[model samples]
Structure formats: C-alpha cells, structure tokens
Target: MAQVLEFRLPDLGEGLTEAEIVRWLVAVGDVVEVDQPVVEVETAKAMVEVPCPYGGVVTARFGEEGTELPVGAPLLTVAVGAAATGTTTGNGSSGGMPSAPAAGTPGTAAESSGNVLVGYGTGAPAARRRRVRPTASAPAARVAPADEPAGAAEARVAADIADDTEQSGPVPVISPLVRRLAREYGLDLRQLSGSGPDGLILRADVEYAMRAAGAAAPAAPAAPAPAAVPGPAPRPPAVPTPTAAPVPAAPAAERIPLRGVRGTMADKLSRSRSEIPDATCWVDADATELLAARAAMNAAGGPKISLIALLARICVAALARHPELNATVDTAAREIVRLRDVHIGFAAQTGRGLVVPVVKDAHRRSAESLTGEFARLTEAAREGRLSPAELTGGTFTLNNYGVFGVDGSTPIINHPEAAMLGVGRIVPKPWVHQGELAVRQVVQLSLTFDHRVCDGGTAGGFLRYVADCVEQPAILLRSL
Candidate 1:
C-alpha cells in the first residue's frame, strides 16, 4: 500500500513569512517529481518559484492564484510507496490523482528523496519515524488479493485521507486560508491564547482578541487640570464644553491594497521618516567640463562612458576623502559603522513601482563597467525580474532626478544609508565665466543625509568635493 505524504511550503529566507500565489505550475491530478517547482509565489522580498519535495500524484492543491499562503501550509500531497512496490501503474485513475510514471523516484524499499528543500527532506524527520504496518504473520503467509478491502491500496489511501483532520497538539489550524488571513492582519500565531476548542485559534478568536486589545488601551489622558490656588476663587461662569461638529461623508473612491513591492517601499519610507533626523543641502555647479570629458572619453574609446557612471566615479572619489558619509548608525549600540566597501545604489522607476538596485563594490568598477551594470539592472527592473539581493545592501544612493526634468528636490534618504546625492538637469544657463558672461552647462546637486551619522561639516565637504569634480573633471585624475 502507498503511504500518503504531505508537502508543506518551505521558508524562503530574509524574514519573509507569507507569499502570494502568482501562478500554478501543476494541477491537482498531475504527477510531479521531487524538487520540481509547483507554484510561482510573490513574497515581500522577491518573486520565487517554490518546489515540491514529494514525488507522486498530486492529491490536492491548497490555494488559487492571487491567494496568499503562510509558511508551513500544505502545498500538495503525494503517494510515495506505490512506484517502489510496482502496485500502481501509469494511466490508472483510482482516485482524482493521476498515476503517471514519475521520473525522480525516491528509490525502492525506503522510497524517499535526499534533497527536498533546505529545512525539509524526502523522508520524515529523525524525531518522528515512519512505521509500515505488518501485512502477514510469516514470510510465506497469505497475501490478500487486490480486491479485498483488508489489503487494498486504494482503500488504505481513502482511509488515510479521511483521518487527516485529527490533531495531536494544541495547534488546530486546518486551512491555509485562515493562516494567510491572520498573517495579513499582523496577528501572531504563537500568541494564540484563546478559549477555542482544543486551544485552537479560530478566525473569530483572532478578531475578538484584536478588538479587546484596542478597547483596553487607554486614550491620551485629558489635558492635565490647572494647579490649585491657595486663596478662595471668585464666582466664575462655567464655560460650556464645545462639541465637535460631525464630518460629512465624501464620495466613494477606488481602493488598492499594498502588498508586494509597493508595500515594501511604503514601509521603508515611513520608517525612514520616523527614525532618521535628516536634512537636505543643495548647491549649483557648472557641468560643462564633466560633459566634455565624457564626450572625449567616449570619442577616443573602446567603451562609451555614461553620464551617470561618471557621476558615480566622482561620488566614489569624494567618499574616499569623506568616509563618514559612507556609513550607517547602529541605534541599539549607539555606534557609527563606517563601511569598507562602497556599494552604490541607483533609483530606477518601474511599472511595479520605484526600486533601488545596488551595485556591489562600486569603488572598484570602472566607468564602463558601472555603465554596463546599471543598464542591465535597469532593464531587469523594467521587466520586474530583479532578485532580492540585487535590491538591497546599498551603502549610498545616487539619484539622477534629471531624467524626470526636475531642477531640484529634497528626496528622502534611502533608510539605513547615510546619505543620497540627487543630480538635476544639466542645461545651458547664463553664467560669468572668467570675467565674461557665457552660456555654461549648469546642474543642481542636493544631498539628503542622516544628521546622526555626521556633522554638517562632513556633509558639506562631501558635496563640495562632488561639485569640484563636476566643474573640473581633471580633479578626478589625482584619485584615479
């Protein structure tokens, strides 16, 4: 008889708890091999293809596309022992499971896989051993035919599927939908203290607990009463407490939920505003020399130099002088950490939303290399194919708001990073050059920095260095 095994969703690291099903790769009745991707899920971190561990017929699917499922929820179920025993054959339709021949067989006798996932494997864990019931009294004992209910494989499967509802512990979660709902509302399952049956936390239980918590929290105390005077008070008319007028209802409007990339951006931006005491400083500089240098480099060269890449090179040189600007703060330990490697991130806008793709070891890359990497990451961003690692761990951000035709902006600092440099449009403007008025290519640069990381002097020095390179590209020769 084939034993039915359940496959649960494995954890995709980086502290993600749940994922939304973007597409289903396999159906309920299809036969699947071990380690085959069964569903494509979109987590808060990135888009991932989740693989199934068990190899056999897919008994049941738990969720539909666009439905969110929490970790440890069942992705599918498979029968393990049928192929090893040769009792099940292809093209057989006993139940809803398709009995096609599986390619990645778990092997004979102890049929199972070794590489299931990071946390789970083909067989049961060592703590819980699987025991196969004895079928006969002796080696040559009676072997029941396939028709008898006592020895029938299909009958055993039916019985096993029927008894899946009973639980041996206090965790009484039976549906993935309930888990997803609880996660979406930010409810902790471990804190599932409820009077539910068998200590199970039900939907109503979570809802009631949240309501009780809200009700128990006291509102801000009424304005403190004035201190009493020593002398007796004169007769004073009581001032009526003014009642607040009711607010009128507005017309209904469309609503959209923030769950994926948009939600991640919102959370980070809000936290940055609340935690970082940031300030912005701006200065205008002549960029005619920088543009001419880039043109010269490309004109004589094998690899064309991009404007942003040149700006990145200049930023790297400036950070070498003012290392304090390339650092983040450890609030708990109250220490300022100066990073050794300069990983620069550039802001890219996509259909998904605004995302920052980091270029690792930006200090070591040449202008041509940085230009190539930026183009690759930007294209990936447009196609929404960037991985989580590509989107994180940036030491500093260089935002070219010039692409949007803006003169200046006090853009928010990408949280945890010490500062960001915003470059504006480089256009021809009238300026006094060497005692005569001339049309010069000018640009505005702004730096929004965390005040806690460095004092204003360090910030000003870094901005001034960047402006110097922009005005006289030859200044970069010493550092290069």
Candidate 2:
C-alpha cells in the first residue's frame, strides 16, 4: 500500500505569512521528483516557485489557483513507496491515505529533499512535528474535514482550543495572518490562550474573543425604564421619535485588491512616506560629455556599456564620497547602518507591477558587468521570475524615469534604504557651453534621502557630486 505524506506550505521567508497560488505546476496523479517546483505562488514580495521535498505521485492538491493559502497549510498530499509506482486509479482518483510512507523508494520515509524553503525541509526536527492527541474534554480539537476551507478549519480549531489550552512561553503562534488579525483588533496575544496544539494561538481564538467581548458589552442601559410610575398619567406614553428613512445603497465601484506585488509596493511606499522624513534635491547636468564618453567606450570595448550602467558607476563613486547616503536608519537600535557593499536597485516596471531588482555587489562590478546584470534582472522582472532575495537588500536605487519620456520626478526612496537617485530624460537643450550658446545633452538628476540620516547640506553635496560626474565623465576617474 502506498503511504501518503502531507506537504504543508513552507515559510517563504522575508516574514511573509501567506501566498496566492498563481499557477499549479503539477496536478493530482502526476509523478513528481524531489526538489521539483510544484506550484508558482505570488507573495507580497515576488512570484516564487514552491518546490516539493517529497518525490512521489501527487494524490491530491489543496487550494486552486488564485486561492490564498496561509503558511503551514497542506499544499498537497503525495503517495510514496513502490506501492505507488504501478497503482493509479483508472479515472485518476485519489484514494484514501493509509499510514505514513515507509522507507523504500525515493520520496519515501528515507528519501526527501534537503531544501523546500528557508528553515523548512522534510528533515525538520521531530520535535517540531510532535503532537499530543486532544483529551475528551477538548472535543473541539478534532481534525478539519477534507472539504473545509483551511482558514475556516483553522479558525474553528483555534476557537475550540482557546478555552481548553493553558497559555505560556512565547505565545505559540506560527501564522503571520493570526498575528496580523490580533494586531488589527488590538488584542494582546499574551492574554489569550491559543486553541492549537501546544497552546498555539489561532485566528478563531481571536475572532471568538472579539465576539464574546461584543456580546458582553452593555446595551444602551435599557432606555432608563421610564423613571416614575406616577408621572402625570405616564405623559400620554410619550410620542416615539421618528426614525430616519433608509437610504438607497450606492452602486459598487470596481475595486482592485491590494495584494501580491502591487500590494507590497503600496505598503512599502506608504511606509517610506510615513516613517522617513525625506528630502529631494535636483540638479540639471550637461551630459553631452558623458554620452560621448559612453559612445567612445562602446566603440573601443568588447562589451557595450549602457547609459544606466554608467549612471550606476557614477552613483557608486558619489556614494564612496558620501557614505551617509548609502546607509539605512536603524530606528529600533537608534543607529545608522552604513552598508559596506553597494547593492544598487533600479526601478523596472513589469506587467505585474513596478519592481526594483537589486544588483548585488554593484560597486565591485565594471560598467559592462552592471549592464549585463541590469539586463538579466530586467528580463526576470518582466517574466515575473524574480525571487524575494533579488527584490530586496538594496542600499540605493537608481530610477531612470527617462525611459518613460518624463523630464523629472521626485521618486520615493525604496524604504529602509536611505536614498534614491532619479534620472530624467537626457534631451538636447540649448545651454551655455564653454560660455557659448550651444545645444547640449542635458538630464535632470534628483536625489531623495532620508532626512533623519543627513541634513540638506549632505544631500545637496551628494547630488552635486553626481551632477558633476555626469557633466564631466573624467571626474569619475579620480575615484576609479
């Protein structure tokens, strides 16, 4: 008999709790190999392919595409062992699961993947999976029916376990959704006992508590019971006040849900606005020389140097002088974290949404290398294949809004990072060249920096240095 093993959604890291299934790579009755990506999920950060650790015939899948599943929810069930090799229901039916798979074949008891996601694998410690069966008194702690939605089942379990479990030690909560729910309602997790195994707090527990509190609230003081029985014949039973007529409901407007990449961008931009006191300083530079320099380099070089890469090189040089702009504000520690490596992120707009893909160790790369990385990341962004790791850990961002045909924009700083350099269109404009009127290639450069990190003087200096480098590309040679 094939023993079926359940695979839960592993933690995708970056503190993400839930993910919406965008596409299912494997279907029930399909044989899968260990470390094979079975599903593509979109989290708040990026689109990720979730690889299953067990190699076997997929017996059943949990959520359909577009369904948001919480962390630790069962993603699918796989039947392992030699018994699964030749057995397939004629109509591709998923039979009942027997016992756990014994070590026989790949994806069986002995063979499982070493990598599923961060901090998760088939080889996880047995202590993490240990469970004690609920006693008769805890009748509510039964397993959810197969057909029940995971959220609903979890909520039900949580509500039932809240009253039965004793609370202690770090408030056994694993789901980020539960934490968010408790936070939104201002419920302290420490005060409530969880209704999950090992006293784990669940969403239902919070909802139950909220409902109980609402039901227990005093009801309008019973309208004061009409005071005196002998009040002048009860004042003719006092005419009741007229109630307002019900108004017709307004037509519902189309609402785009703030979830996935767009949702994450909204949150990050909002946080950047609310938390960081930012300041923008812009300067127009004559880039005629810079353009000529790039052209000359490309003519003599083995690899074509991109304009953005040159700008990135300029940014690296400028940051070397102004390290304050290459750091983040550590609010909790009350310190400024100056990063040693320059991982520059550039804004890339894709079909999914606007995403900033970071080029790691950008300062160490030549203009040619930076150009290649930027192209690779851009392609990945457009294809919706960027990982969360690629989407984060940026020290500074270079936003070339020029490609959009825009002259200038006060770009929002990609949050946590102290500053961003915005490059506008490098158009030919009439200007005084060498004290003579001429048409020069001019571009507007703007720098938005966290005011908490530096004052206007430092920001102005950084922007000024960048503008200088753009006007005279030779100025970058000193730093190089």
What C-alpha lDDT values do all the predictions have? 0.72, 0.76
Local lDDT at 344 for model 1: 98
**Per-residue lDDT of candidate 2, residues 1-480 (tens digit):** 224578899999999999999999987655667678999999988898998877655657899998999999999987543323333343343332212332244664234322111111112133443322222222122333569787885576455334323342223443434554555555555556554333444556667766665565556655556556554553357688999999999878977888899989999999999999988989899999999999999999698999999999999999999999999988999999899999999999988889999999999999999999999999999999898999999999999999999989998899999999999999999999989999999999999989988999999999999999999999988987
Candidate 1 residue-wise lDDT at 38: 91
Off by over 4 Å in 1: 1-4, 79-82, 85-251
Q: Estimate the TM-score for candidate 2.
A: 0.65
Clashing pairs in 1: none
Write candidate 1's Cα lDDT for 198-233 as tens digits.
232344555564565556555777998998888978
Candidate 2 off by > 4 Å = 83-252
lDDT score, candidate 1, position 214: 53
lDDT of 2 at 55: 61
Q: List TM-score per model, in order.
A: 0.65, 0.65
Q: How many clashes in each candidate?
A: 0, 1
